[model samples]
Target: MSENLFVKWTILPQEPPQPLLYCKRCGGTRNFRSSGKIRVNANGKRVDAWLVYKCMSCDGTWNRPVLERQSVRSIDPLLLASLCANDAKLADRLAFDVEGLRRWAPHLKEASNAVVARELLSETPARPLELRILCVVPCHMALRLDRLLADELRIPRSRIHALEKSGALVVFPSASRALRKPVRDGTKLLIRPPAEDADWIARSAAYGDDCP
Candidate 1:
C-alpha cells in the first residue's frame, strides 16, 4: 500500500462576519468601500465629521467613526451569490449519471471556469506527496477517486493528486492480477505514508498569497 492513500489534514479559521450591504446593480451583497465624509446637523447647527463610506454593494453612502475605522467591515453580496451558485454548479458538473445536463450545462461551464481561476490564484503551488498501501479486492468499488478520498479518508483531491504524482504512492496489489491494474470499481487498496517524504509534504501545505 502507498502512504499517499492515507489522508493529510489541516485546520482553517472560523467563519467571518457577513457583510451588510448589497449591490443594487448586480444584486450582490459584496460592496467595495469608497471614501467620503459624514455630515451632521444638530439644533439648527451644521457639523461635518467622521468618515463616510460608499457601499460597493449599492453605491449607497453611510457614516461611521473615523478613529475606529479599522474595525469596520462589510459583507459582499457577490461572494454570497458565488457560494450558492457554486453549489449548483458542482452538482451539475458531477451529474453525468443523471438527466438535465443540457439545462445546467451553461452554468456548469461558467462555474468550472470560475473555479479554475480561483484555484489558480488561491491554491499554493506545491509538489505532490507519495504514499504506500495494501488492501483487499472489492473495497474500491463504485467510487470516484475524489469522492472516495474525501469520504472514507477525509482527504482532498488536490492533495491526493499531488501525492500520486510525486511517487509517494505505493499500491500493493491483491493476490488477483486484475487487482494490480489502476484502481477501479470494487477493488480494495491499502494506503500508507512514505516516511522519507514527510518533510516535503509539510512544506507543500504552507500558505500562499492572500486573496485580492
Candidate 2:
C-alpha cells in the first residue's frame, strides 16, 4: 500500500493591493487606499461606475472606473445595488483588480500580504505527500513556492532545492518551474521527505500559528 499524505493550502492575500498613482494635490506619486466607496453616473440607458480611492499623503480622491458606458440592464441588480450602497466586499474586489487599476494608473505600484491557510486532506499519512495549493483571492503576491514551503516546513530553502534535485519534491505540470515562480492558485506539490525528516515535516508551521 502506498502511504501518500494529502494536504491542501489556501493562499489568501490579507489586504487589497493599493495602487500607487500620481496625486495632483500631493504634487507627486502617492499610494492610494480604497475609500470603500463607489460613484455612479447614469446617461440614458448607460451606467458608468468607479471605485473611489484616496491618496494617503493628501487625501486626494481618484475614481478608478469599474464600469464604463455599460448597459444598465447588463449589470447584475445585486451588484448594481451593492455599488450604489458602496458595499465593502464589492469595493474590495474592484480594488484588487490589478488589471483594472492599470488602465488609469499605468505605472501603479502593487504589493500583497501573503497569508496561507492549510488543511489536511487525507485520513492517512502516505509515504509521499501530495500538497494542493489553492489561492483564495487574486492579488499581486510576491510569494514563491519554495519560500512558502521553507516557511511552512520550518526548513531551509536549500533543503527544498536538494529535494527537488533528488526528485523527492515534484511539482505538477512537470514543465512548471514553481521554485522560482510566484505562487499561484491551483498549484500542486508532491513531496517525499526522508524518513528522518518526517517528524519535522509533521510539525510544520502549517499546523500552527507560528508562521514564519
Candidate 3:
C-alpha cells in the first residue's frame, strides 16, 4: 500500500471583490477589475488588501483594496492536488511531510517535495524499473493535446483510457498497455519537439517549480 501526507497552512484575511471605476488617464468610464486575498504579518499586527487592474482603453494600471475576514481551514490532499493543478507556486510552498505517517497514506505529499524521483536497485536479480518524465509547459503557451503528446510521450487525457483499453498505449518494462503517468521532479524526461515547442519548453524549464 502506498501512503501519502499533506501539510496544511492558511492564507488569512479573506478579501472581497470590488467594482471598477473610471480611469483618469484614458477618461474611459469602463474599467477592468481584479482582486486578491489579504495577507497579514506573522505577528498578526498588520493587515492589508491588494488587487491589480489594468485599463482597457489606455493600458493604465489600477490597484484596489478588499475588506473581509475569513477563517482558516484544514489542509487536505485533495486541496493540495487542486493547488498543484491550478497554482504550482502555492503547491510547492504548502506541501510538506508528516513524520511517522503510514507509507500508503493517501494524503501524503512527495518526499522532499520532489514530485519526480525514482529509485532503482541493480543487484536484486529482478528489480522493478521506475521511469519518470517531467514536462514543463510555459505559462504563456496555450494548452493543447497534440503539443502535450509530442513532448511528454503521453497521450492526452481524452485518449488515455481508451488507448489503454485497446492495448494501444503500453506501459514500459511490463509491456502493459496503459497511458504513461506524469513524471515528477528529478526524473529525466525524453523531450522531442519542433523548434517552436522547444522554445516554450526551454523558457518554462528555466524556473524551478520547487519552492524557494
Better of 1 and 3 by lDDT: 1
- 10 residues in a row with least lDDT, candidate 3: 4-13
Per-residue lDDT tens digits of candidate 3, residues 1-212?
21111111111112112234567788866434332222222124323322344455666655433212322233344543443243434322222212211121223222211121212212211121221233332111122323333333323455434443554433333322213433211223323323333333322222113212
The C-alpha RMSD in Å for every predicted model, in order, reads 17.6, 3.2, 15.6
- Candidate 3 ranges beyond 4 A from true positions: 1-48, 55-57, 64-142, 154-167, 170-212
**Each prediction's TM-score against the native?**
0.23, 0.82, 0.24
lDDT for residue 204 in candidate 1, whole number 0-100:
31
Candidate 1 lDDT (Cα, whole model)? 0.32
Off by over 4 Å in 1: 1-132, 137-140, 172-212
lDDT (tens digit, per residue) of candidate 2 on 67-184: 8999999999998899888888898888877777777887665553467777766544434444333334346566777887887787899999998999888877565577877676
Q: After superposition, how far is residue 148 of candidate 1 from its true place, in Å?
A: 1.1
Q: Candidate 1, residues 31-67: lDDT per residue as tens digits?
A: 3332423332222222222334456556666443322
lDDT of 1 at 80: 30
How far out, in Å, is residue 188 in model 2? Answer: 1.5
The numbered model that scores best in TM-score is 2
Model 3 TM-score, all chains together: 0.24
Quantify all predictions' global Cα lDDT against the true fold.
Answer: 0.32, 0.74, 0.30
